[model samples]
Target: MVNKSRMNRVAAAMAVAALVSVALPGASAQAAATTPRIDLRVLVVDDGGSSVEAITAELRDTGVPYTRVQLGGSGRPVIDAAFLSDVVDGRPRAKYQGVVLPNENPFGEGSAEMAALVAYEAAYGIRQVDAYTWAHPGVGLEYTDSGGYSGQLDGTQAAVTAAGKAGPFGYLGGQVAFEDNSALVPESYGFMGRPRAGYTSYVDAPVGSGRASLVGEYTHDGRSELVVTFGYNQYQQQFRLLARGIVDWLTQGVHLGQSRSWFAVHVDDVFAPDARWNKELDCTPGDYACAGGEGKESTIRMSAADAQYAAQWQQAKDFKLDMLFNGGAGEEWKAENGGTDALTAQLVADRAKYRWLNHTYTHPFLGCIQDTTTVPWTCVKDASGAVTWMSRAEISAQIRDNVNWATSKGISVDRTELVTGEHSGLKTLPQQGQDNPNLAGALADNGVRWVGSDNSREPAQRPVGAAQTVPRHPMNVYYNTGTNAEMADEYNWLYTSRAQGGSGICEDNPATSTCLPAPLDTDTGYLEHIVPAEARTALRHVLANDPRPHYVHQSNLAEDRTLYPVLDRVLDTYRTLYAPNTPIVNQSMKEIGTELGRRAAWDKALAAGRVTAYRIGTAVTVKAPSGVLAPITAPNGTKKQLLLGTADFGTAYAGNRSAWTGPEPLQSSVTLRLPG
Candidate 1:
């Protein structure tokens, strides 16, 4: 009762690389034999002709056929949907699989092209990638006619950088420095991980739903030659792997839901205005009780004592510490020489638990304003009681500012990830993606290369994972998006079954409770809480594949000095690869985003009905039925198992006959084995 089709596809993918490695001498012929020879078409946007020729010369040597189309070159239409019309209309068979936009324009022309490309991607649903640039895409350029602000810099100097945004990524991947546009070409999102200067930070919000994320500022790394953000360049190869993994995800290279893994834990705050969520969230209501919490029965003062507890996180070796949510602006980010260095210490102590990441300064629910009615450990939202999100600039401030706070002061994530205040509101930044722009465009703009999250999808959902991430993507996708990504209290339909009027999660939430970031043990099965070991469990699944999944903590990349225990182990996963595939030497997210552009083309071709059959060696092929065209039912293991309330992801495990299940089909060489 199991299908091996997906397994076969994975095997084939491995074969493609195996072929090259084998031929490289001392490589495995079997690996090379399984690799499929693929001819790819490439597009070079805004390349000014010279770079296009350079790309052609370089890629052609790899045995992949290609075609280069420059949007910013002569005879090419501008970004007003002129050229894209032909491609999506299914007219002149667009041969390019991906587009690479690389340049250095202080006039901000690069940002315009990047924005246009993003728009085209959205209109056509075609993926676009911005290569390593001085700045993140759409930023450093002039504000758009619509007043949306596309340019990121203020002419000569970059007005913004991604130095602080590294917090979130740090929690999942290792730490890395972001590339600043000043040292590099200044293109947004093109060159993440470039060496950049760093600063110390100290911004903290109370634990609430209406705070902002702590971001970083970008500086330059003179040694590596590229402008860099903190912890970004520190782990360059991590991004190369990240790019590879993203490609795997886009090409269906890695089917999610195919494997069964553990839930990824998320440590964050609750929305309650009690002491726990007060100091940083509702301390300044200006009410008579402002000085005191809602009575002693429900008061949580972010006391200095918490720092002692947070320090223990370093030894929690149960799992990979795959992720760490900044949990709404607790009393930490704002920690200064205030009364209790204890709260300050605890704030930094949390990073010791796992890799630090960009959680946005103040951890804004992004829907509301902050309230500083109380002093020390008491902050609240505005009287309007309405929530608000930070503007693109504000969000950037949080990220950049925090990075400076953590790095300069000596406290931050190990790596960096791109996420949002609450997984639901992951903005494309400056409000672009909602208008149909490709999400990748923003990451490309900032040069963020590594995307890290480890979560499981609800039962019955198909598996969706990034292949290049190796040990990272052995299981599911949307690691931090929903309950599978992190636990949620909302109990949305995704967790319920349609027949039961929902995804079955609402039925499970303690039968009535509406709290998220659930406790370790919940009385209700439906409200099952996520566990800390969720990340570890997922790693084990990857290890099951080969006893040695490429495991890397989120922090190891940027600050190798801290991950002494795991550095050697992390490298061991690929130690056997021929030629010692040394890390891509600081591959930025922008570069990976560039590689993913081709993936968008493939998807567009399928969506536009232009591509029907993919002749995979004549025998292995993909073809939709006549007029009954639909994507092949590639069964990833998503639906193979039962839904156990996930941990950490802050998801509400609304139990239902539909969400829970039994064992799953094991197809990989590795299998999950729990130590009794």
Candidate 2:
């Protein structure tokens, strides 16, 4: 018999998933029609109110260009009748696409400024997004002052109404943070009765061919096509979404200036002591040492490696390279630098030169199997040393200890991400998605934003715990031998090739049966072994500007000799081959991962096909989802300079054919386009 119920359940789950992925829907006719625009900008009318700074800050961060008109500023026009008349008449000087009322009525209620705004809304159907509560009635909304509701709710959860989910407010349609202590309620608003005509429980109905979006019940007579939220202290993410959405709705589709790609290099094990694993060299078949049964030989000297790194730090300091520094090597570095105080001072001085990422103290294989049994990585109780995962507490301690250690040493470490010891926990091993659950929880609790993973797992940026997991290219270039026991021999064969000076192997080695002719230094090994591996790995993601974090260990700075060349060459090669013309942006793993996550959100919004874009001559009109900043990829395949709103709204031409213009607030629509 067919299990119809089971099939139905599966179908429902799929539908829910689909809905969550692409939440925005088409706008209703009753709501204001999408306003097309050449540039995206809003007029921020501030009377030096409390919310002005917060609103403007978000505006700046989210790339919403705005022209500030401080009502209380000296020499500014008072909220008088003349100003109202000019504003309502759509004076040539008032070239704005939209208006943002941050808090309270900039002008007192019933003032000419408030009346002017009302008239302006009537004359032009420009969108207005209000952050404060009291200004609702001034904009022609039927708001009962206080409406018998007033006070403070923080971190309140808000659910989007069914109507809201189907309307232009669908971008903010999910359950989000809501704070509304004082809200202007409509006289017709009732929570328990049969809903009123213009009431969606959250938003007031269309009054003047425009709708009012609200987090709480707010009055809207519809005189102005306004979106008002009587919320205070909203989550930054939610606030950003709301701000972008409002701009998109007002401008039709937002013209995100341009796109940018970022790349970074990671140097791990900077201060870590040379492990016993790195000293072995094997003679492969055809080498004279193969017959002597001397396959595994310890030949690397740690002191020489340390000296090279010490010298290289000067070059690193000079470059001011925004590189990721694995902090686990702090102790070793302290000892090498003479004392902990010196080490701390050195790191503190170099704070601006690099971003510190966690590499747990006494680094252990976070998830790698020690033996046949799947024991946790923190299995201190297990004498056999066969462990797979670390307990949640152990994982937490591992991360917290490293961060605390960094802090103690005056080294600021971003707790957001930790390059796991050997990239162990992030390995694509026994099965996909089979990660250490305890580690995930610990990371979430630590408020980490990103963690390192393997590029072979198709790493872009995926959510792991509460953080974005960004994996680097699998093929790595390091000072030490290959990771595993078997690879120790393979590492020797490659590291001591003719191109790498062909040294460090004895005659009659079991694997090669031959000895290397000369000793290969770290530089030679980098050229012969590491470069090719890195080149192959770079090819996979460099072109796409994917996060290809070229990782290296401490010893790679040198070999048996001092003053070696490895990391510099690696960086030079990456810059030359992967990003010749494109400027490389060396960001920390956390920054890169956070950007990836943001980009994903934008991509999702763009992919929804909800954006309506129209370009007329040099003018373009765009209607896009909120909380998204889409980059304008030129049709001619030009380098897209990011157009995130920095100052007042203006298009950044940057030699492109289009002559960009500043976005004007308080207007319904304008035309702008990329040059043909």
Candidate 3:
């Protein structure tokens, strides 16, 4: 009983359904058929400018792999559609997730290369960063001449906007002050302009009577660009502060590298005394070069009151300091002072309050036997002309005895961690050109896995037997000084010219030193000038994602407690500039060493092209060498795939979650499900 009209309607409905499926596909089916594969790599087009170099440096330092195409350089890769993207296995594949250009238009306006870049960005939904550019309509901003301003940005205070706080720069608190290192030299320069339609400002500064954008996002033609109106080098404080946000925005919160601000302070000579700096002789009394100063030797050692104060300060700041201690030195001091050291007793009472690393039994020079007959001591050599190095037994005893002593006092310490006195047992530039022959053997004997080195001398981590060197930054608060006046006087002696009553060292080494305009007033200089300078330097390291611990001496914790002012300023400024989500990452010496080792391995894997990471839809796949961990940063809710179920991807940091991760059990690669 088929009705002809009904049969016709049913047939027509079927045909319409087929047509609709062909024209507008279902979400899952469409994604499966044509999902875009976006590579977790950045393409940097360099114009040989400081701004471009600055961003490039950030990418490199953060362990984010990138390809550089030098503009105006011979044999540079052409910016063509085929070069930017391709179809792989019937799906579109973008070679780079982000593109960093020297400016809004690096290949010139209306050029084929520029056109190709624009088309590629639009097609792949790739973000671009105008590393540095002048404000104009091209970047969706009014010209500086029109109700805007352009000039040096040094000493200017910029601020993150509401839009920024809600976007990639959510980690920052608000203010960003440009550094004015020298009044005679211009450090930063920029142009500020009013944002036009489709432009959202991230960071802005005062312009005329109102605010204008310094860094902002401009959306147009199915693509977006992060436009930066400022000029800066990689070392500039402003650049370091803003680099993480720039990279985050470029990658859209998903990348193959993770970054966190790390800060750790180590107080060396914890149980020993530091020699006093002689203002009259312009040298430390106990040092080799200070002649006729033996009888006048005075030492700066922490007292029981200072130890109590240190514990209180740590509780107040919620920070822990690493104690690089010498057990024999403390015992000797105790014997000299009626066999009762109040400082030692106080520190032992609060043993669990601070981290501890072995600084040897006695703070003896372990590199070589010194021939002290010469003014600048030389290494002693045997009859055969070979260097006379401290024996392995002696070195191992120094390391072993200290750990035993700490254990006896019920103080928890990692036996694998050691920081030799003066970073000895390693190479000393003018005297010992190489590590002591016995040093490696001694370190291996003691089961030392992490040994501290001087960052100023050996900045890079290297192996010594089974151990790796954990480079530490020497804070400007001198080991010899326990007072502010001594620090200032020494600073003036090193930085001022002979005409200004200094040693004239700054005049001789102009490349590495800056001569002060005038000698600092010993009474007021350390608080006014030195504290800010040292704090700024330390903050720069923290902002750079450097995990190296900064080392000051026990002397800094005694007497006037000179180190607290600088530390307070650094911590306060850091808190003011960053939100709680981006808390400073503090790690132990061994942890820092492990981190550096893992980073080195990861970097090696990336450089050898042994790692591949890409995102398809909300799924990220990262494949690396089996033993190597992959560094990943993604949205807060991202989850890592497991053999059976998913797990939280990484710990939260800088407004995202990140970790050095490896594949789950039975999995071939590390895979993550990104938040929608």
Candidate 4:
């Protein structure tokens, strides 16, 4: 049994160490590359429980390659005479650093398989990490005790062993939710089990000539083995953190780099109206039929909402905001009068704080063909299913005009980044999967390096035309939060038919303020519509380490009473749950674009499989494949030569490479010769 007092001291010390690393971002990746790493992969054994997929997902996400074996159900392990020989020379002959047993049954006495595993551990000094349920003599406990702890306990008590206390896996100190029916190990003491033995959350057990920290323990032939346990899969995020710590521990501190995720919000369709904003149910002149019955255009007045949004932004400094503008609106405002609107002025005044991108001059659907029969501009599709697109010159004009307008307004727009109004002219071209050369040429001429796509269509980045296309999840405020009628109308208008859905929230005529039959409950919308979307986005980003740049419209902020309150709730929840002190980097869309481009370049280079390094008496020579952007991690600043092989390939790095933010793919090979 473990000593409770010693375990408590150990946990406290370990927590401090872990926090120190978390507090200082990038500390885990700052160590010199000269440190020798243990060359072994993890062996995951599934005993038909909830942890197989969960464990595999974490391993895959973190880039920890693993071999899996189904040890449950019909394939259950049995003790036969040949089992010892099979275990001694199993199919998974790869050198395994450790094993993971999820909800496993105890390998009974005299069992050949169990004996073989014990013999292997005794010979190799490799231990096992168990999650939730496991019963083996090697685990140092039996499930013979009838009574077990249950109910909603917050976490394990602070009786962690001294070794555990001084290590990185002491995450029981972190905020975690414990569920009902969590099994208890009767043999262990302190936070893990009944208070009979010493407080033993973790124990450095003596195994043959080597030492192993037993989170749970057992013995055979006077030899002990270590087994670390996390409660269950319900506590996935917390469980993954502990799993990561265990990987680090078992591998002797060889870092399995996990990228810290980032997030941003891009507000689109921000532009000046062709005419002074009005409250009446209105439409573009000569297009009255388009507005539908009592439908209003530009109903969300930015003049009144910009200040509120600014205040909310001040409160949420860690949240990134991108203002995507339609240059035509600003031009129209300036051409109409002296351009003195409070909304535009406020945006200009706070210009330095937010990232700005181009939507277009007039915000036309660039992917759609122009309808000459319409007044200003309209899109049409022919019988052949091809949507008519604007000419290259016309597309180029939209890009250039926007850049000029934004520059004149002191809004520094990154010419390399553009979010086509409605994400038009993207990979989903009507006829050919190939992009319109005209639009591609226009973007290239305008120096646009990155274009935005939607997760609804494509969840990852792809090359389109001359620009690299990055994606975001569309967080439409109109969805879910709006009332039953409001939700129905919005969905219908977008996907099915505008005539069928009516105009929904935009139906209210400003003049009477009573055009629409039903209105939105903005108060409850955040919880109903926004919270679900936010939670999904946050959890996805956390688990996959993918960047989620959620996109909304300027009108989303103006819709209903005000969108700031809802925005506040959604962002706050994400901050608290996914990333609190160890916060995700709040980045601009352009920055995100740049990061994605670099990642692509690195991935491309890594895929070519030509990276190699060798050193003899400090004369180091490295050969990196063409187009690889990241530096190879090898023994440096010493006379020692680092071992090189395919095993080192595909190792993940946590941050961006130096100055690798450009959209252009690397085009050449790199070779380095170092002087001793």
* Every model's TM-score: 0.29, 0.46, 0.94, 0.63
The digit string of per-residue lDDT tens for model 4 on 231-345 reads 4452344454455445555443332224444667777766543221221332222222444433344334355355456646655665657888886875576577676666777
User: Model 1, range 1-676, lDDT digits (tens) per residue?
Assistant: 1136435534543443343322223212322344322112344554554333433333332112333555545675443333332322322222333444443222242244433344333222233332333323122311122222223221211211132222212111222222232343543222221121242111111112221111222211110011121111211222322222222222222111111112232333211112212222223233234445445323223344433433443354234333333433443534433534444454554644554555454555332233344333222335684334344455545555545545754655533344344432332232212211222343343443444222221111111122121112322112122222122221323344445334344446755433222222212322322221223234333222111122222212111122222222333332321012122111222222322333333344444554332212211122322222122212122122113322111111111001111222232111111111
lDDT of 3 by residue, 628-662 (tens): 99888999999999998899989988899999999
lDDT score, residue 413, model 2?
69
Question: How do the residues 200-219 of candidate 2 rate in per-residue lDDT, one tens digit apiece?
Answer: 34433232333333443223
Best by TM-score: 3
- Scored by lDDT, model 4 comes in at 0.50
Worst 10 residues of 3 by lDDT: 19-28
Looking at candidate 4, the ten consecutive residues that score lowest on lDDT are 655-664
Per-candidate Cα lDDT values, in order, are: 0.29, 0.46, 0.90, 0.50
Give candidate 2 regions above 4 Å deviation: 1-261, 274-349, 372-388, 431-433, 479-541, 560-582, 633-676
After superposition, candidate 1 runs with Cα above 4 Å error: 1-318, 322-338, 346-353, 367-390, 412-416, 424-676
Whichever of 1 and 2 has more lDDT, that candidate is: 2
Q: Native-vs-model 1 lDDT?
A: 0.29
Residue pairs in steric clash, candidate 3?
A: none
Question: What C-alpha lDDT does candidate 3 achieve relative to the native structure?
Answer: 0.90
Best candidate (score: lDDT): 3
